[model samples]
Target: MFKKNKRISLLNYWTSRYLLTLFVGLAIISFISAAWIRHTTFQNRLEMMEFLADETVYRLTDTSGQNIGPMGSIPGFIGNRDRFTMREIDPILYVVDTEGNIVSSNRPAPPGSAKNVANLLDGEEGTKKITVTNEGQESVQYVVKKKLENNNKVVGWVLVLEKKENLTRVNQAYGQLALLIGALAVLGWCAIYSLSKRLAHPIKQVAEAAKQVQEGNYTFDLPQNNKEEEIYELVTSFKEMANKLEQLEKTRTELLAGVTHELKTPVTSISGLLQAVKDGVVRGQDASEFIQMALVETTKMKTMVGDLLAFNQFAVDAIPVKVENINVNQLIRDAVAQWEVMQDDETVKIQMDFLVKSVDVQADVVRTQQIVTNLLTNAKQAMQGGIVTITLMEKEDAVLINVSDTGRGIAQEEQAFIFERFYRGENKKYAVRGLGLGLSLSKMMAQSIGGDLRLIDSNSSGTCFEITLKKATTL
Candidate 1:
């Protein structure tokens, strides 16, 4: 098995990666800068040496090579002496003849150095630059040579030699560059760390909040004043989800209690009535009535159980729906007529308004009839006596079946949840005996047949529900 990777906080992850990148990038830049600085410094020093060599030759040639001494300085050449002094360069000066013999000197040099200088004299009469390491000291030196001329004739040479380390100030330049790079690196790390912390803080809080929510704690505080738009949206959406889950949890608890009470009531009634009859508490006609009451309770319980099972099957898409073309007007009329016959109360009247004489729709016949009957039953239960109107209208490749009732409409607050399973409105919770699955089941059945059932309107005046089905195409 592979080893699992260790988890890390966002702050550490981002900060470490950014810092590594920053340092690596800075390192590359520093390397380039240092290389360039070293080259430039050496070039500038070489130019200075050339200038000194030319100046020395100009002074010596003016005297016609006569006033030069062993020290290689013009005895009265104040300007030349000051130029060398101002530049602070201590270089060995030499005058070599055309025969490659040393003529004058700035200071006493080793025999090896004098031989190296002689070997460099190639009889050329123009200025030339060279780099060579002294054998005695084993240190590199920069040498510049200029020809000494008199009356436009070749005379000798003036050579100025300075140690390479003394000519170039690369170390000082590197020191300053290192300081600047360090400061920038420190500042960059601070900015990256601060920004990363700010971004990671909100995400950590959200993770913690999610853990709390998993533990059944829906209430928690989160940063609402985040300046980032995406972070603010994340926090806002999570809060809304938690609130919705909390509402669903409360509804679930209520539904469980309601289910227990609804099922237990009928069972208790049946048991009591049967026990009464079995104990010989009633006899003859009374005993028979008592037994009948028990059977009625038993039937009610069985109906409730059947509804629960059907709802579960429909929810899981386990029930098959056979859709076919049928005359919607006739189907509604027949369902209303059958439902009317079953209702014992005559005051509740149902009327049909057929806007189209004949309309064919693709739907499941049994499910359609069941949805209409369920709506009628709910309408009857909503009022003592009222008119339930069923209207059929055809429009734009679809047919609409509207079931309206002139009864007490659903309350404003409860209308949104009428189609939720096991959700009974406050007004009907105590007055009605049901599992609150009628509208929910009807909607599921309607949708399974490629149609929809929805509440179009509900108010204090009345309520209206519309069922939409696809119209059959004529070949």
Candidate 2:
């Protein structure tokens, strides 16, 4: 079996990685800085020694090669056995003649120190490293030399010798640098930790909110006000989504009840009427009337069932549409005339306005007629008596057919959901019995035929819906 990798919180994830990177970077910097500090310190010490050698030669001799005083009487000179503890380094000095003889000295030289004088040519002056073994222990030393001259001719040499052990003590500066680097690393880690926590806090809250939503609890507290722009947008968008899902959940429950009630009503009525006739509770004429009523209920039930099936088919794009070019003006007029004959109320008037005499569009004739008939029915039902107008206009490769009605218009809030499946408006939910699929189905049909249906305007004055159809290329 393969093991699943464990998940970690965002805070830990970011902080851990940042901490590792910070330390690695600091370590590399410290190493380079330490090496540079040690090298510079050694170079500075060598330069100081060279300066001392030059000064000693100047003080010990005049322009002509001759000693002004004994080396022990010179200022800043220490005896061979004198021990000084206040200075960082104490180098031994020796004055040697051009014949390689020791002329004056500050301290007795260690063994093998005089070998460097013999290696020097007549007036040569420079610094060199030499390893000297004293009392069975090996140690390195720096030897700096300056030429002693009389009238520009070489007379002797002044040498300053410093042990390598003394120069290695320069690491104290490296230690201080390491301390500063350590402090900065601590500060950096603290800043990174705090920032990671701030970023992870809001994300955790969102995750918790999502979990609650998954468990069907849509109401929960979230970090509403965030300073970060992206975090603010995420929280805001998630809140909106949760609210929409809640509304959909509530609508789903209501639709289920409505469907049950709508389907059961006719079934109950038919069953009761048939039982009454079978039990012979009325005479021949009464029996005929009850049977007619049962048949009417049966027909109503069948129509509702058919609407549900057709809607399901259309939703999945399973229904085929036949598209053809037809005269849009004539189509609307014919559809309105046929719908008018079926209405029981004569007070409801439908007025047609055509901007053009003849305009052809590519659309399914039956579906187009069905959309018009549905709009007329909704407009007529919206009020007791009102004018329902159908306006036709042509604009840039398309035809627009607007159906408007002067009714108690739709409620401002309810207007947004008119075309949602099984969504009945509050005003019509109880007064009118329907599954609320008329507009929804009509929209689906319109889109199926390379057309579209949308609400243009609605208020207390009236409501208008527009249907857009593709215009035929020719005739």
Largest TM-score belongs to which candidate? Answer: 2
Per-model clash counts, in order, read 0, 0
Candidate 1 backbone clash number:
0
Global Cα lDDT for candidate 2: 0.83
Worst 10 residues of 1 by lDDT: 70-79
What lDDT does candidate 2 reach at residue 432? Answer: 83
Which ten contiguous residues of candidate 2 have the minimum total lDDT?
A: 77-86
TM-score of each: 0.62, 0.67
Stretches of candidate 1 off by over 4 Å are 1-18, 39-82, 85-131, 136-169, 211-215, 266-303, 314-317, 320-421, 425-428, 431-433, 436-475
lDDT of 1 by residue, 1-475 (tens): 9999999989999999999999999999999999899888777877777877777776775556564443334343324343474343577777776656676666666667667888788765444456665554466676777877656666667877777777666677899999999999999999999999999999999999999999999989997999999999999999878876776677788988999999999999998888888899988899999999989999999999999999999999999999998888877888888888887779888888886567888988889888999999999988779898888888998998899998889988677678988888888999999999999999999999988999999987889999999998799
Q: Root-mean-square deviation of each candidate, in angstroms?
A: 7.2, 6.3
The alpha-carbon deviation from the true structure for residue 323 of candidate 1, after best TM-score superposition, in angstroms, is 6.9
